[model samples]
Target: MADPMIALATGLSAVLLFLLMIGLTVYLLWKRRQDMRRDNQLISTNSVIPPCTPVLQTLQASSYGSAEVPFFLPPSFKSSTHSAMPEGREEEEQWKQHPHLHIQRGSLTIGSWFPLGSLRPDLYQLPEEPSEWAQPSGSTVRLCFAVQYQQEQEQLVVSLLQAANLPAQCQSSATLVKLQLLPSEDRHHRQAKAQSKGCQPQFNDTFVFQVSNNSVDQCTLRMSLYSVDRLKKHHLVGHVLLPLRQDELQEAAGKVLWRDLETDSDLPLSKHGNIQVSLNYNQSLQRLTVVVLRARGLQCPSNAGVSVQVSLQIHTQVVKTKCTPETRGSTPTFNEKLTFRLLPVQLDAACICLEVQQVGHEELAEVPSTRATAPVSLGLVVIGPFMYARGRELEHWNEMISKSQELVKQWHGLGAANNIYNNNQT
Candidate 1:
């Protein structure tokens, strides 16, 4: 009886110990799972609120000036009615609902939770008034003008009028006027004959330009006045630019308009000078030859002579050969030749620039002697790729390129240094 009782006690003790071990194992597993879940929740919270960098914060602050621009809560932070829905699908739905946030300029405020504010009046000022010529209106524009007296110039022996301003100073004894439709390369242009020159010279001659209704906004009527010198070179006196819009055209259509001629900023009121050049290309030798022939209408101080130099540039490659300085005079003749070695493949991208510079004098004497000393900048003319040439320039280039190994000579006009090249590129 004693032995059986002892055995039962031993069995009960073993069973109790086994049950305790199993309970301990289950508690350990549950605690680990709770810790993992807490960690995952912290990670998701961090992802929802991204960290802002210093640079971005500074940019936002500077953009608002001293104004307190509010920052509204993102869609993800906004209260939602569907909070009970599945987590993954709800986040996606919130993003889809608020696809874009429209924020007006200077409306952003700092620290405030609401994005409600009127745009600063100073920040949202209206743009500048557009030019009358840029207005888009479909109305026929008729431009009429008469060449009136030009004030200021003393030597007015002969004069010519033109609707279009010539690139180089005109070297023609005959005074004539030319008018052409804008942006068209056609040969349809109007002209008027040359007339004798005088202060307040009355042209009394009236001309008209008929612009299309659609193109009236872009059309500009240019009136150029040229004086004929003893050498028969047409020196540019001055020009006037008339914008042809519907309102201005309608108001001035029947009435004769007289306005003062405005000279180019670089060119003097009295003509400075003009350079003449001849271009020839030899296909067989792959050489380009340029001849600086003569310059006319050069203005100089009393008893002071002018010296001139010519430089030829193809792209950035400048020719080592520069023409020798011509004799001191208002009109100097160089008759020097400059040659450049080139290949057929290079001509497509080549641009020829001829720069005529005035040397010898420390400063160019301004007219009337009271004005400040001005630097001498004679003029520059450029001949670009064949495809880019126009009118007479195009004709000249075609003639040269067509005749292989033969010299093709033509007179080219020069304007203020860099003006022709800059205008062409623009």
Candidate 2:
């Protein structure tokens, strides 16, 4: 009995010791867990997160005050959820993910809330029906830009002159050349007898150029100003280079000749002035130049000897010029008439040129210009060759001639010549 009791006590003591050790370990673990939780809370509190969809929702929630919307939201604040992992952890995660996602923002200026995909309707509109049209916000273009020159501390209006002359047509057609100018101070505004210029304050510049667009194309114009003051003595101002297009030149060539076709059929050919055209063959001269004439009515001539004094003058330029000048400047211009003649159904390209300037002229020397001719059918070419010009109307030409015969003869002084060159100018 004594031995059993001793053993039981030992066992009970051992069991109690084990329970104490277990309890201490549990308490320590609980305290450690609490500390860890506190550390996590501290880290989360210091971290920041960008707003996402919720921000937009808040923005649209109501028409709140400007302060309600965080004005400094990063442009990349596209996330929809918030995360708090300490700033360091957050930065590490972001760096590991979107290294290229640049964080940008708009200015402090408060603008209207525009949806992401909103677009302007006027962006798409028919050219003829312009989205908007206004005859220059101002009537005068010259008033907008003025030159203020400094000369003896006094403002002087400067004048520019053409260093060299241009083609006759170009001269009259208001073309400008872009070149340096040695200022001419002698030029002063001629005093107006009447108050036509109006009582406007002097501006710094005399002319202003603006680019305008129309349905078909765009154009730039330089306008004169009423008054201007120069802050500096004649300064080397900007140059003016005119815009001359090859297509425009070709079109003008056609129209200039077309205008001369209005002569009365009954009128004597002698009454018309001779047409003079000087052609220049560039290095890449084409084998032929084509002149297409429409023949409606005319008396066909069977005889080939009929002479229609059409003169073609061509020239080889000493200095080559580009199709379009490098600079865009406008030149002064006037109007002049270009006279040329053509016989019905006759396709002729002449090589002719006149030496301009001094007496060392080169008009008499001309190389023949080549032409590609279309073979007319023998049947048509031979039919009543004398009755009318080839590929032209016989009855109409005769009528025109018959109708003007009286005036034609009156002008011709050959009593019977009136049968040819007489018609109403209108």
Candidate 3:
């Protein structure tokens, strides 16, 4: 009996040990899994993606010409002479000026055909020459230039023909012509030196601006002349304004027209307020996000149910979004996020249009009225790449592109719509 009891006790002990071993194995696995999960969490917490560097080569101001091929000197010479070259900021100022002047590879240089100081069209008198031409006197300065809108190519060609009777400057001062399109003075085009005999300088340089047909009527050409001395000090000589609304612009295609320059104090100011927005682009996912944060100092009429609308134009695709529930004041807080599926290639041509509209309470109703009513646009602001955007608008876009998946916020000044809607969008 004692021997049998001992054997039973040993068997029970062995069974208990086996159960203990199984429990230990299960506990070890659970601990190991917990450790692995903690490690994974630590790894994920530390991972960060750095902003991407812009890979596009920096082209000179004149280099941004769409079809005009510049004579690029050797790399060593270009780098050494770049600082001394007057066109250092041409990429930023006149990037949009030349996108239509196509020069064949073997074609003669621009200077060969258009000689300096050659007798061209008379800007002051069209179709007929004045019996005796007299120089413009007093503070008035005249700019002689030619403008043509090519409907087929959608290009606005501006030729700096010549300037006669310019305001006298110090003999050491060299004249430069700064060209920029209004209502948005985002980019400026300049010609370093004009062949001058006294106050008359001849500039046969042609600048081509890419513009859509819809916004052509509202476009205005501003030519600002400046005198830069040997010390690089700049003085405003005068500026000429050519409003596209005039009938002469439509009639005088490639014909020279003379305009009187205005003083610096006469420059116009933006009456429209400002809008706050945020932009983000995810290259890997091919997505774009726009956030309409708020608006301030809006110049809208006092009306009920005032709301803001934001439009995204990607090539021919246009998507619009608006803030719900009308706001009363000129300053409206939207904080709305708009997302778009954009391809990598389409980013270069994408444009954003924001409009302040006064919507009637009746239009906001769910009844869906049959009567068609157009929302009155109070103020408008458009932002995009260098093609149609400048200043803060272009800077915001560039920041968004360089830092993918990162949000870039900016305050853009508002301006009159001026039918800027015709800028190639659906």
Candidate 4:
């Protein structure tokens, strides 16, 4: 009984000792965890904190009392942050003042909602239906040349002195000057030799055009400038038209005269000239005879020849085309006859289109083919019944139809070729 009591007491004491040890360990661990948490909180509270940065901000009110709003840009701006803020503020103010204006790819545009594409600015707009003689829009041309007429020699001399301030395109090519004397029967005109490629070319070359003393004052001097490349390509730059008045020529003889080059839209229109024609129809032979008498008050280049082209058209399709021999001068006489075969009933539907064209010649034989030097239409005259013709043209056609085999002669005014064709199209 004594041994059992001692053993039991010892076991109970050992169990209590073990429980106390576990309680102390748990307390220590809890205290350590609480201390670490407090230290973290204290350190975080005492440390510095940065202010929040906004992606976008509102600037001061503009003079118009509108809120200026900055564009939403990330804080990591590409440029310096300090500089970006001022630029943004200025831009924001400008945008608020002008809602229609906006910056696009660094350029200030007139519209904000839509982007501009292939649109020309208002500053470069040109007039609609600009006159042929109107000053060209791009860089202008200026020419320097001299004209002299000697009474004793009965000869007119033209000297191509120099050309200044040529268009920039001429820098890659050689320049030449073509000279023609108006109202003179010079079989062939003269052209100066091509000079070195430059914006300013000096050509002291002189050309002679024979003119009688009686008609010297009635003559005019025409000068045309051209650019020719090494590949034999030709480009007409501009023209200088100078009338040879006796007094002006005498005062300015051999002295270089500077003139601004004018546009080359000098094709002779209907208002610029007139043409006479005679028509006769033979009912028995089923043929139409048209005689081109002559043309007067025409305007053409000096180095060009004039001819009349007659086209017989049934609706939009042309049946036949005939042209007279090319003649020189503003007033030329053709007196050539062109005949077309057709039934009498066909005359009601058939129309005739006459076009006076100027054929230009290039004196330089080396440079052969280019559409730039092709024949230019000077004027157009159409003759037919009713819808195909008007006024004098209609009367002429009616007269010919009424009196078969009887010649009906009339004068017709010239007009633009496109205008005449469009008016007569089916």
Candidate 5:
């Protein structure tokens, strides 16, 4: 038979162990509740406020032509004393009633041209000369200089042309203008006559200019230089339009005749995220793309995990084209809808990449990303152990959030839920 005292001791020990377990359970419940509250606070504080429809500032100022230019000078120089070396005169008379003329001398040595290197096209102009017979005061004397280049020859061919596409606003006031080019050969001969010497391959040369009746309102020059050797590895000079004049060059203005935006070219979305970008056409591929990415955790959606939602609004250009068939007797109309999509993401801001393409050539990229995407969100995932042990705590949190939401809904419902909710009275 067992001793009564021993039995009593065993019973007491078992009861104590049971009580300890209960205390641990209560403590754990308290901690989980606290953690959940903190998480809720964070989520509430960082809640996503759906972005308002973007007021696109893509009213690109009317553009006409690329305004970049490349100008090159020789690597070395030797200063020669002029009979009357006038300095600072060119600077003073550059903006006077008429252009002040000065003559300076230098030589440029030509090496193999880089296809698109330092030397660039500053500008071109064709001025109308006042006929000796016609004594007209100031009729708009427009000058248009067309610039082209020989890729292989490394020569710049400038010609008198019309800016058929030039904007009217950029046109100058009616006045007389002079069109001229400094003859390189004449300079060479003059130097020869003065020096009393034959031509040695002069690598550098100086130039002189003299003006009588008219002023140089705006002076621009574009020089296109490329590699002289076809096989040598060299830099290809990208075309540039350098403005030599101190003031704004009127020729730099242009217009965007047609623009297309592809709303669907946005990048993949990450949840609870937002993105913002310019609404415009992509130049390279003639397409647009917006992109957004976000990080989400492993929390369960229903119980202990955080899930983020993403939202997007899309805008695109509607183009109607009437292609006149050269072979047919009529103009055929092609009706096309440039379709785009704004994908929804959860948790963080979204980055929407946009792309614009013709229906058949969808594979080719039309443009690079204009900017990063919008309406971002971030997600978090919690382990199941936390959820399983603290299921009641999660329930409690949901209950509280649900109650708050319900109150808001009821309040809004009474007022018909106008967006602003500015009305103070019930």
Candidate 6:
């Protein structure tokens, strides 16, 4: 009974002490949490802030429209203050504007864009057919021909045709017919005889060709009509081209197709003239020697002399020489030799052109007739780069190259001036 007061005071003192200690501990924890929250808010705010450097800002603005803030911020920072931040809200709006900036949940795609692989059809739906044909498959066909022509301007056309002076002519008789196969390495050709001069000449002929199924796509039958001359030089009159179509081949075993002939639009009518030349290359002397021997059938008017102007060309270099004029009504023999200094390698692109011209001389008062004026071109001949010429020109080139240092003489036909000059100029 005497210690009850003392015990009550002691219990009250212990309870007060325990309460104070708990209050202090709670206050300290609350302050620490507030500091941590402030620190986290600062970090989150700073993370969204753009850099101060102009270069960085320019790069960011160019690519992303603004500074890029990562979406995967710390969980504590995000749950507390992310939504409350103005920077964060602005970043969210930017990401919404450019949806490509967000991490999509499923398949990612550009706007309205699809992969090319998805456009391919299923392999099972493809058609079944051989892409290439088998080899050594072919057929044979026989073709027959008949020709008839009408003469216009009558005897004048015949005289022009006989002269071979004009570029165009109309004649029926003295025609020779030939058949040729196209795209064949052998250049298979056949011919029929000439008919007598008449208003209407008729020809009945036949030809056979070995055709292949694989080759029919590229094969063509060419029939040409020519006017034969006394010099054996055949002038092209007209021609016709027939492509071996599949329908034609199916019914062409013994077909006789009569088709009208048309003028050969591609053939260039050549004037009657010729130039003879000799070429010799001397390795020891480092020189190429060319001899202008003679010119025949030149178109020279009366009282005019014919002369030749020879030009040698290599790359862009040109060397010119001339021959003395010969009297009219005589076969002009130039016998003029022109020499060019060139190395063996330079001969690869070397060529020569001869121009036949008519020169006129007029005697003046007390002046000798040696003064010549007004030269007119009759025809031209070009013997060239050797590699590009065919037939006689190629044969002559081969002969000259095979027998170097020795002269090789050959006669080359001359055509219109435009033919050779235009080609070589380019």
Which candidate achieves the best TM-score against the true structure? 4
Query: Can you write out model 2's per-residue Cα lDDT over 4-68, one digit (the tens) per residue?
Result: 99999999999999999999999999999999998898677643544431122223223455454
Give me the runs in candidate 6 sitting further than 4 Å from their true place: 1-270, 325-327, 361-372, 386-388, 418-426
Query: What would the TM-scores of all predictions be?
Result: 0.31, 0.17, 0.32, 0.34, 0.13, 0.32
Q: Can you write out model 5's per-residue Cα lDDT over 1-426, one digit (the tens) per residue?
A: 479989999999999999999999999999999999988986776434323311112222234755544332222211243224344443232324222111111112122221324443433455778642232223332223333333344333343222121123222211111223221223221111111111111112222333211222222232221211234433222111222221212232231111111121222332322222212223334332211111211111222222122222223222221111111101111111121232222102212221111111122243223312211112211111222213432333233233332110000000012111112222
| Cα RMSD for candidates in order | 28.3, 25.4, 37.0, 23.9, 48.9, 26.4
Q: What is the C-alpha lDDT of each candidate?
A: 0.50, 0.26, 0.64, 0.71, 0.26, 0.55
Residue 48 Cα positional deviation in candidate 1, in Å, after optimal superposition? 99
As a whole number from 0 to 100, the lDDT of residue 150 in candidate 5 is 34
Candidate 1, overall lDDT?
0.50
Ranking of all predicted structures according to TM-score, beginning with the best and ending with the worst: 4, 3, 6, 1, 2, 5
lDDT of 4 by residue, 13-70 (tens): 9999999999999999999999999889867764332332323333544667687856
Put down candidate 1 lDDT per residue, 284-350, tens digits, no spaces.
7888776565566655543344333444445566554355444454556555566778787777656
Candidate 3 to truth, TM: 0.32
Supply every candidate's count of residue pairs whose N, Cα or C atoms clash at under 3 angstroms.
11, 49, 5, 2, 109, 0
Show model 4 residue runs off by greater than 4 Å: 1-270, 361-369, 418-426
* Candidate 3: clashing pairs of residues: 61-90, 61-91, 65-98, 66-99, 93-188
Model 2 weakest 10-residue run by lDDT: 406-415
Structural RMSD, model 5? 48.9
**Least lDDT summed over 10 consecutive residues: which range in candidate 5?**
407-416
Query: Which portions of model 3 miss their true places by more than 4 Å?
Result: 1-139, 170-172, 184-192, 245-248, 266-426
Taking the tens digit of each residue's C-alpha lDDT, what string does model 3 give over 1-426? 899999999999999999999999999999999999988986776534323211123333353566644443211112343456565353322223432221321232223333444543554465655632344344456777778888889888888877766655633457788888765646656453677645777778888888788887666677888887778987887776565633445788755566666563432335776676778998888778776665666665445555667777876667544453466654565555667777889878888888876665344354346522445566787788988788878988898998684467667777876322233333
